[model samples]
Target: MASQWHSLVSQKIFLARNLLGQLENSNSVPAKEALLQGTIELGLRARKLVLIMIARMYQHQHSQPDSLEALGELIGTHSPEIAELNQLASDGRSWWNHLEQLERHQGNPPMARKTVSSENVIAVAADTGPDRSKQALETTLGAMKHFIDILEDRHSEW
Candidate 1:
């Protein structure tokens, strides 16, 4: 089980990296959008996998934490990188939530009319712009690299 989670973490990081590369080279708006979406999904997966890896490592040294975030706090003691990665993870998650909100608002006419004000619509539009997507991709890549480093160091200790 531990090995499987480890493999998943590596795989997700690779996928997220590949997606960001593709996003960078993409010329069409649709292609970029698709790649950005994939990158965010893989980023989230990588974050979860790293959290699980930390939890697994903690199991041997101490009792398991109640949640992934708590496990991350414990691991943060070993490396400040974990706390940095948590901030990056939070940014990536908010980016995903913004995209979801835009999609949901656009898809539901009644809900948009009843709930989405002009200011909210403008916010959603801003969230869907390429600038934030590029920033999110860069953040994801940094987080992935840091996460892999932590995992590798942990593995090497064993």
Candidate 2:
């Protein structure tokens, strides 16, 4: 069972890395759209990975966490390193939420402010653009690499 969990983690890491690479190289609209969706997918994968790590390290139980917040509760004070990874996962989750909200609202401003239909959603999206996505991916990839190193160090214990 432990080996199975490890294999699953490894596969997710590979897929996340591949998506990051594709995102870095692509600039077309359709490609960027696909990659942004991929970011959301990878964010979920990251959450699952963190949950698995937390369960194995502390809880000794195998069950899906209800949400990232629930995972946070599971991780409470157990491991600072895992907490850092969870924070990164939260950031990844936010990227998708932010993008989705922007889409749903058609780039409208705050309610207190005048709502302008002339507002360009594309420009708003550009503000949170590929550059931001690239940085996020780089950060996630680095964290995953660190995670692998930590796992390798504890391989015998597992």
Best by lDDT: 1
| Candidate 2 runs further than 4 Å off | 24-27, 67-131
For model 2, the run of ten residues with the poorest summed lDDT:
122-131
| Tens-digit lDDT string for candidate 1 (1-158) | 45666777778877877878877678999988788767766665666556666666555344455444576577664555455544544663643344334345434444223367666565433233333456656754575656567666766577
lDDT of 2 by residue, 9-78 (tens): 6677667667777875887989976876675465456545655755565546765665556665675645
lDDT of each: 0.59, 0.56
RMSD of each: 6.9, 6.7
Least accurate 10 contiguous residues by lDDT in model 1: 123-132
User: In model 1, which regions exceed 4 Å deviation?
Assistant: 1-4, 60-131
How far does residue 138 in candidate 2 sit from its true spot (Å)?
1.9
Residue-level error in angstroms, candidate 2, position 114: 7.4
